[model samples]
Target chain A: MNIEIKDLRFTYPTGLEALKGISLSVNAGEQVAIVGQNGAGKTTLVRHFNGLLRPSAGSVWIGDWDTSKYSVAKLASRVGYVFQNPDEQLFSRDVLTEVAFGPKNLGYEKDKVDALVKRALSLTELNDQTETNPYDLSPTWRKMVALASIIAMDTPIVIFDEPTTGQDAVNVARIANVIAELKKEGKTVITITHDIDFCAENFERVIALSKGEVLLDGPAREVLGQEEILAQTYVDPPQLTRLGKMLGLKATVINQEEFLNALK
Target chain B: MAFVNFQNVTYKYPLTKTPVLKNINLQVNEGEFIAVMGPNGAGKSTLCYALAGFVPHFFKGEISGEIEVDGKKSSESTLDEWVLNVGLAFQNPFNQISGAKYTVFEEIAFGLENIGVPRNEMKDRVDEAMALTGIRDLADRSPYSLSGGQQQRVALTSILVMRPRLLVLDEPTSQMDPIGTREVFGVVRKMAEEGMTVVMVEHKVEWIAHFADRVIALNEGQVLMEGKPNEVLTADLLPEKGFGISRYTSVARQAQQQGLWKQKQLPVTLFEAAEGFTSKGGGGSN
Candidate 1:
């Protein structure tokens, strides 16, 4: 589903104004990454997408449905939120049960739920660990279980929070592949991440936030190219981008192939 | 003599069949900054716990080895006494915050209080620590109210205020943004420069390369490799052994295969990679 966020402003109960009238839109099936330093309001902005947080001064529309009008549970049918810390959400005894929880809570038929859970488990490469306790797995694998739990919901829009935070290279590749699969299914995928390289590789569009304001927003290459502006948010451009700049290359580079091409 | 020594160290939790750390032997000189790296379950955290005197003492684990820090044997000293010489700040700063404190200032001073530092000296030490970590402004804020990155700074500052001879950090910036990461590393580097030995477990290879004097790679609780940051990080076996090498290093490795990069040594940081690629070199398309 498409997302339309207009002039959004949010303030915590302690009177911290997190979002300072930010605005953006995302088309259906578009993969978008929201990036900024810690406490840059990336989490605050995306929480509005699934009705977890309401706009104090503006509006967020997921398709035609206004976020303010729906409860988080109501929005769950359309927006699947995978929290940053898996320990915060995981409650099931085993991986299969954890993966099935979302769909089951949404009241899907048992057969459908089973299929969805199995599909998610396989996608996350957790099929062998279906009977294993999630708590017994490593934190990296727990993160995958969390992702699989949300993907089982099969929502039109999925939001992942810092998917690569503590993951290794292999796990990171798994997460990237999951996003690619979601995009193939015409699902809108939005992620809040600190891994700029991962963002540069997987996402086409990027929205950079600074103090709850939209500091920069555009295709990943264009937005990441603004190194100085990004540095203001305490973000470095993708490694290849920085490498290209440091090399004084004529073209903007965001990946290895481009860096090699620039060398030629 | 080494400032920190671990000889034939092997440890297992209460019920675990396999030791988390296996036959690990390492030595760190005084004031040397060392970074440890490994995949999940590689015993990186276990190593940190062992150094910080938490393994056999706190966890009640079966540990067999000799661990010595600053002339004091870990097996011989009490946890309280060991902590006075070696301070540890780990991942998940939220858990590190003492729940009894209201303000960040009080939270930092709590450590000194528990260790029985005089009241008058506590204030100066806390002030100096906060300044060193750049958290002076957060002194009055509630420790619980701060963000993860801010809380991490508080945790680090709390440990740093103790002025322990050796500091052990476990992914102190795992939850931090890039800026927070840099700031924390700055404090760590400064501490090492000021003659405080440090052993850190971290995944951010670039930052480790920038600050660490030595790098130790661990796999399945064994020391896989140890050397200069560039040497170990750019080692060909790192990826195969499930170590997380920097992206720049990997990219340069790929370029080498295509005859696009001429450097004999792969770059671990962006600046090094840039300099190598841009330098007037041989055996490359450029």
Candidate 2:
């Protein structure tokens, strides 16, 4: 399903304009990343897809459905949101129950729910901890549990908010694999990240937001190469990309292979 | 004796059978900046709590061996007395906020006020600390109203004002942007230069390579490797152990294997990587 936003504007109850006159679209199965400083309105903009926060002006459409007109639960079948803080979303006694909660809530048949939960648990490597209470797990493990819950829901459009925060390298690699798997299944993946390297490695499209407006949006190669513009939003290009620039490499490189190829 | 020493230290949380930190032996000289890197469940945060005197002191469990700071053993000092000279800022910035204070400035000053520092001296210290973290403009804002990055800065400022002999930070800049992260690293590096011992648990490999004096790699409740930042961060063992190393290191390693990289040592920073891949006459291509 495609996501279309037209001049979307949002204001908090406290009178802060979180997003202003933003317009963009993600075609079906496109992998996109959003990067910016803390108050750059990344979260506020993505929250529109699930109808968590309605736009103050303008419109948001997920597929043919107007997001503002659909209930969050109704939209859950299409959009799976993985929050930054796992603590905010996790409330189940055990990992199995937690992973099952999403698909079951969507009213999937028991057989399908079990299969989805099993796949999610395996992908997140939570099979061993299925009997363990989520709270009993470390913050790192809890993050995986939260991810598993959303994966079990199996939405066509998935949004990950700072998925790498507080995760170790191993868990980060695990999460990246899950994302790759999602892309293989032709799911549209949108991530808001501070880890530029992770974004560069995973997403093809990059969107930079600054002070409630889009600063730069294009292919990761072109957009991330604009170091000065990304700096305006307090972001930096991936390490390999920066190194390529410093070495006077003609091509913009975002990953190790491209960088090695450039060096050659 | 070293300023901070851990001798055969092993600890288990209450009701937990296996020890989170096991048989650790370490030493840190005064003013040294040490960065700890490890996978999850590797006991990095537990090490921070132990350094800040939280392990056996607050989170009591089966513990042995001495945790000594500044020639004083942890067993001999109360948690209150220990924290006075060994300030700590951990993973959750939200928990560090003192709810009694209405503004960021007052919240930072709350620690000094409790110790009865004169009002004038307290104000100066709070202002200076906030300036160090570049959060001086947030002085009047409520702590709860700030963004996560802002809150992290406030938390760090709150601890820096105490001017402890030993500083323990657990992923203090986890939520910060690239610029915010650089600023915080600069502040901590400055603090170390002024003769403060810092033990930080951080995952950003490039910053650790640039600023930290030493690197300690932990895995499964033990010290897997310890050395200078360049050595530890570029070591093949780090990647095998599931530790996140710099992309520069990863790239350079692959390049070296293919005989494309000429440098004997892998690069942990972008500058080093650029220099390594560049030819002798200032060009960087095959």
Candidate 3:
């Protein structure tokens, strides 16, 4: 299902305007990455998709359902929002229970919930830790469990908040693969992230936000390849892009692997 | 004398029988930038806490052998005294800060004020600390209002204002984005340049290798190797230590695989790697 936002404006209880007159649309099965500096209203914008935050003005529509009219629990089945801190989202003792929470809440039968939990656990590669207490696991494992929980909910629109924050290269690669799988399963993936390398590698389109406005939106390579625009958004473009600009090479190389291949 | 010393130290948790750190003897001189790197649960954070005198003080455990900071035995000193000599920043920034209503300025001043620094000297010290961490503008802002990067800076400035002789940071940039990571490391490198001893437990070896005076690798609670960045970041050794080499370093390795760059030295940064590639003219599209 496609998502449409029309003139969305949000103001906090303290009279602070977080998002102002924003409008955008994300198509079905489109992998779009939202890039911005700190306090750029990235989080505020994504929260609207899942009805976690109702806009003060304008409207957010997921297909025919108006997000403002739907309850969080009702919207959650259609839009899965995974928070940045897994500790904030995961409260169950074991991975199985954590994954099952979402499916059960969606009114799935007990047998179906159990099957969905098992499937989600296997997808996140946490099958071996099904019985382990979440607190006893590492931060990365906890994050995977959180992702499994959302997967068990089986939302068509999945949003990830900085999924690669503290991950190492291997774990990052694993998350990237998971994202790829999400795309293969015909899910619309919207990610708020600052890992420019990961964005350049995995995402096809990019939207750059600054001071509660959409500054740029285009192909990930074009958006992230511009050093001045990236610097303006408080983003450090991938190193290879900098190297490319410094050497007067074509402004297309974004990673070392691509740079090496281009050199060849 | 070394500012911090761990001599054949071994430690185990209360209920667990296995040792978390084993036969580790290391010395950190005053005003040095040292990075401790390893995979998950490699006892790096354990070493940081032990050096900060948290093993027996904050955590219940059995520790053997000697660990000292500034010639004072770690077990003998109180946490308050340890705070004076060595300031520690945890991997999670949320757990480090205190005072819900405290602004960034007030948070930094809390430690200095507790130590009974003169009221007249507090403002200047706080300003300097804020300036050092590039959070001077954030002094008036609430700690909760800042971004992850800005919040981490506030936490760092709070520790830096204490002017501890040694600073122990556990993955200070783990919770930050790429730009934020660069900013934090820039502050850390500047601190080391200004003659502050910095021991960081980090996983991003590429960023650390550029500024670290020494690199120590740990595995399963034991020191696997310790040396210069080039010596420790070698392709043959890093993979064995369970570290995925930096992409720049990996590219250089692949170039060597294809008989391009003939140099044996590993390039840790994009600048260095690019220079190496260009100077060799072996794979320079430019």
Candidate 4:
């Protein structure tokens, strides 16, 4: 599942033009991360891919299917969205049930749903809490349950909204591993996040959005190396990148390995 | 007595089997800025509520232990009276917004109104608070129309306008961008400098390292470690206990294992990490 948008524009019912004319494309099985300040039209753009919001102008094509012709439910089978707030979407009593709900809703067979739910739960390290009430778990665990719920859908495209927010380092590592697993399975992963470090390490492509426009879109190193543009969007480069800059390293370094290698 | 003291404090929510906070003993001095760090369900937020007099007062929980703030006992004072000295701003800015008010300025003044602040004085205080948080231009905008970061600033300004002696913030910048986070931190730093005590719960280890006077690592409702920011944040056992240590510290530790880093102390901030890695006998430029 590829996503293509051309001259996309959106206006809320309150007369707020959230997204100006914008254009972008995501290749199938590609991992991309969208970053910007709060209310910078990142959410407005992603909502179009899943048909949650109709484009006021222009067109969004999900693998040649124009989003305008499809309802949100119709798009759900192709695109799975894990909301930023897990509480908003979590309605089931236990973890296993919550994970099973998505596949069941998509008309999967009982055995298939059971298999997918087990796989997702194991991947997210939530297998131990399968029978536990989701609300009884900590917010971090609840976030994992939410991710497992979406993963069980087995969509080719998965979209995560600020998945690392409010998570500790360990939980953040877990989310990154999940994304890696999703990519390994040949699924396209798109994340809108404030965690620049996570984005630097995991994503191949980084899109910086500012005020309903694409500020920069390129490889992770190139896009994140432009600190001035990122400053305009209120994003700082990853810690290692900043460290590399401070050390007068000739190249941009994103993680500890690169930082040490650059030092050598 | 210290400005704030918690003596063998433990609390459990209504009908809960286990206590969320267990035998937590701590103390804070006046005008000191303390940052509390912990994993989820570690009782950091409960500690904030105890400081702000909401744990037992608002929630009506089973609390055993003594909490003192500025010579007042938490269990003895009414919630209405306790809030006058200790103001709290939490994670969700939307939940903190007072829907009764039309504009940001009026929304900030709503707190003062509830506590019966005089009309003339309320206007002056509200303006001052707005100026402090850099939200003066948002005075006339509807509180509901502002962005999440902007609304968080307004929520903070509402509490600051009350002129509380102590401010308790729980991940107040989670919804903010880098610039917004810095803006809120700048305001909080200024308040601490001006003799207002503060206890903030945050996950951004880098920011906390720069601003906090002390760091407390909480785990499973207990204080796992407490001391200067540098000592607690760079502790070897932080990661094992599920505390969110700085990435710089982790990276430096890894480099040390590879025989690349020579610093005696691991770095918690980017500046420190860079200096340690670039200084004499260190890795880079060797």
Candidate 5:
């Protein structure tokens, strides 16, 4: 299963162009990250994947399902989108009910919905919070509830919009692990983020958008290695990458472990 | 007098019988840049609200001890008056913006105009605020149309136009990218340099460690530690206090363990760390 986008162009109702001629594809089970600065059309491009927004020009095809013709409800079964703010998406009284909302709306039986909710809660490490109110939990735990809601839907392609925003190191590492586990389960993962270190360490391919155009798209290591290109796009390279370049190192080092080994 | 003072203060939410803040004592000198850091539920936000006179003024709470801002007791001051003297930007930008029909210029000018500043003075102050926040070109744009980062700048500019003596920002850059974060910090640094005090509750240690003059760490609704940035951000103290130490600090500590660099003080910024490593004549790929 592959996702293909060709010559995509999206204009808001106010006649502002958000995405201009975006074209790309994600092979099945590949983890890809779309990175860009603020107002760079990264969110506009991903919202089109799940039929939330229709392109004024061009088309989006998720394994032969034309996104332009599909409704959000129809496409949601194939692609799950986790929004940036979990408060906007999670509204149920408890974590369990929130996770079960999607499966129940999709017409799953009670037993199946219960099992799916359980699986999602366990996968997101929120099983203990199943009985707790989402509003009472911390921001990180609320985010996990949002992820569990999507995972219960069992969409093969999961699109996360800035999953690590405002998260501390422990939560960020947990999210990275969740993405890695999703990849291991043969699910396609697409993330739109501004955390360059998260992109460099976890994603295999990085697609950078700047001013409604694709600036760079390739292997994450190679794309992140180009400090000049990143700076031109108004994106800061990871601190490790900057230190590596300043020291005249040959390869890009993203994490402290790699940076320390490089020094040795 | 110090701009802000808290002496052995304690507070508890109405619903919870337990105090959220316990025996807190701190002072903020005028024109200083202070960063407050802690894990979730650490009473950081509670401290900001308390300073802004929101604890007993807005929320029902039990309080003890004293808090004075600019030499006035918080209990005696009204919210409106204290809000003007000490502007606060919330963690979520969407909650702070007001007047749906207002443009960026009008939003920034609203506060000054409300205070009965002269018409001509309003324009100058608004323009100065916009320029300081790097949002001068966005004056004509609608506040709702801006991105998260741009909206945050608009919020800051709106407060800046009021010329508050102290600015309290609760996680202003939490939702921004690295570039956007730098832009927000740049404005903060400029404000502090121009003799305005800034108190920010932040989680991104690495980004602010280079800029902050002081660090105040909180845990479980109490002050865990407080000192200069270098004095607080260390291996022995940060992890135990539940504060996220910068990756650079972690790496520098490991390098010390491996006998690579032997500086007594840890470098907080990328530039400083690079210079420290290079000056020692050790561990750089040629």
Candidate 6:
């Protein structure tokens, strides 16, 4: 589903203006990454999609549904948000139950829920830990459980908030593969990430928010290559991109393959 | 004998089939900044806890071996005493906050207050620590009101204010933005230079390569390898062992096969990769 925001403005109860008047649209099946420093309103902005937070002076539309009109639980079928901290969203007793909870909450048939859970388990590489308690697992594995739960939801739009944070290299690769799978399935994936390399690799479109304003929004290559502008939001281009610029390559390289291709 | 030593160290939690940390022998010198790398469940955090006196003292585990730092054995020192010399900032910064304090400044000074530091000295130290981590602007903000990156900084500042002899950080910058991360590395690197021994578990090899004096690769509760960052980070065995090699190093490895990279040693950071890729008889692209 497409996400449309018009002049989004948000203010905390504490009188902090988290997001200023900003507007953007994410098309259906578009893999977009939002990059910015802390307190730049990245999280505050995305929270509006699933109705976790309401805009003080704007509108957020999840396709045809007005976000403000829908409760967070009601929006679950449309937008699956995997919180930054698994501990915050996870409460299931076992891996199987946790992964199955989302689909069940959306009132899917038991068979469909089971199938989705199985797919999510396999995709997140948590198959063996189905019976194990998520809290008993290491933090990294717990993150996978959180991911599987959201994936099992099978929403049209999936949001990952710093999915790569605290993940090891292998886990990171697994997360990237999950994103690739989501893209292949033609699902809309929106991620808020600080790992620029991961963002550049897995996301095609990039949106940079700087203190409640849209700093840059474009293709990953174009958006990420603007070192100075990205720096304003406390982001650096992927390592390969910076290296490409430093080497005076003909074009910017955002990933390893592009770097190698540029080298040749 | 080294300043920090782990000799035949083996540890298991209260409930577990196998030991999380197998027999491990490692040593670190004074002021040395050692970066530890490994995949999930590699016992990297266990090692950090062992060094910080949490393995046996707090976690209530079965431990067989010695962890010595600054000539004081971990077994002999209580957690309270151990924390004085060793300050640890784990991956989850949320757990580090002392909810007793409201503002970031007061939260950072919580440790000092605990140890009876003079109020004036406590303020100065907290200020200095916040300045080091580039969180001075967050002084008045409620500790709970900050972002993840800001909370991580506050957690780190809390630890830094104590001025521990051995600093243990587990993915301290995991929640930080690029700028916050860079500033953290800078602060930790400077602390290491000032004779503070550091053992950090981190996945950011690029930053580790730039600042660490040594790197230790861990797997299945054992030290897989330990050497200079370039050697350990670029080792071919790292990937097979479930460790993530830097993108530059992996690209270089592939380029070497296709005759696009020329350096005999693989690059771990972008600068080295750029040099090797652009040197004479290097990449024919640029």
Docking quality (DockQ) of candidate 4: 0.60
Candidate 4 residue pairs in backbone clash: none
Model 6 bad stretches (over 4 Å): none
State how far residue B253 of model 6 sits from its true place (Å).
1.2
| DockQ of each candidate relative to the true complex | 0.59, 0.69, 0.53, 0.60, 0.61, 0.82
Q: What does DockQ come to for candidate 1?
A: 0.59
Error of 3 at B10 (Å): 1.9
Candidate number of the best DockQ? 6
Candidate scoring better on lDDT of 4 and 6: 6
- Candidate 1 lDDT at B97 equals 86
Q: Give lDDT tens digits, candidate 2, residues A55-153.
A: 999999999999989999999999999998788899989899999999999999999999999999999999899999999899998999999999999
Lowest-scoring 10 consecutive residues by lDDT in candidate 5 chain A? A230-239
Question: Which segments of candidate 4 are over 4 A away from where they belong?
Answer: B99-103, B137-147
TM of each candidate vs. truth: 0.96, 0.96, 0.94, 0.95, 0.95, 0.98
What are the lDDT scores of the predictions, listed in order?
0.90, 0.91, 0.83, 0.90, 0.84, 0.91
Give one digit per residue, the lDDT tens place, for model 3 in B165-246.
Answer: 8999988876566666777788888888888899998877668877789998888899888998768876476776566567
Model 4 - which docking category? medium
TM-score of chain A of each: 0.98, 0.98, 0.96, 0.98, 0.96, 0.98
lDDT (Cα, tens digit) per residue for candidate 6, span A1-264 = 789999999999878899999999999999999999988998888899999999999899999999989999999999999999999988988999889888998999999999999999999998899999999999888888999999999999999999999887888999999999999999999999999999988899999999999999999999999999888988988988998898898898898888888878
Q: For each candidate, C-alpha RMSD in Å?
A: 1.7, 1.8, 2.1, 2.0, 1.9, 1.2
Quote the positional error of residue B69 for candidate 6 in Å.
1.4
Point out where model 5 deviates above 4 Å.
none
Question: Candidate 4 chain A: worst 10 consecutive residues by lDDT?
Answer: A255-264
In the range A128-204, model 4's lDDT, one tens digit per residue, is 99899999887789899999999999999999988988888778889999999999999999999888998999999
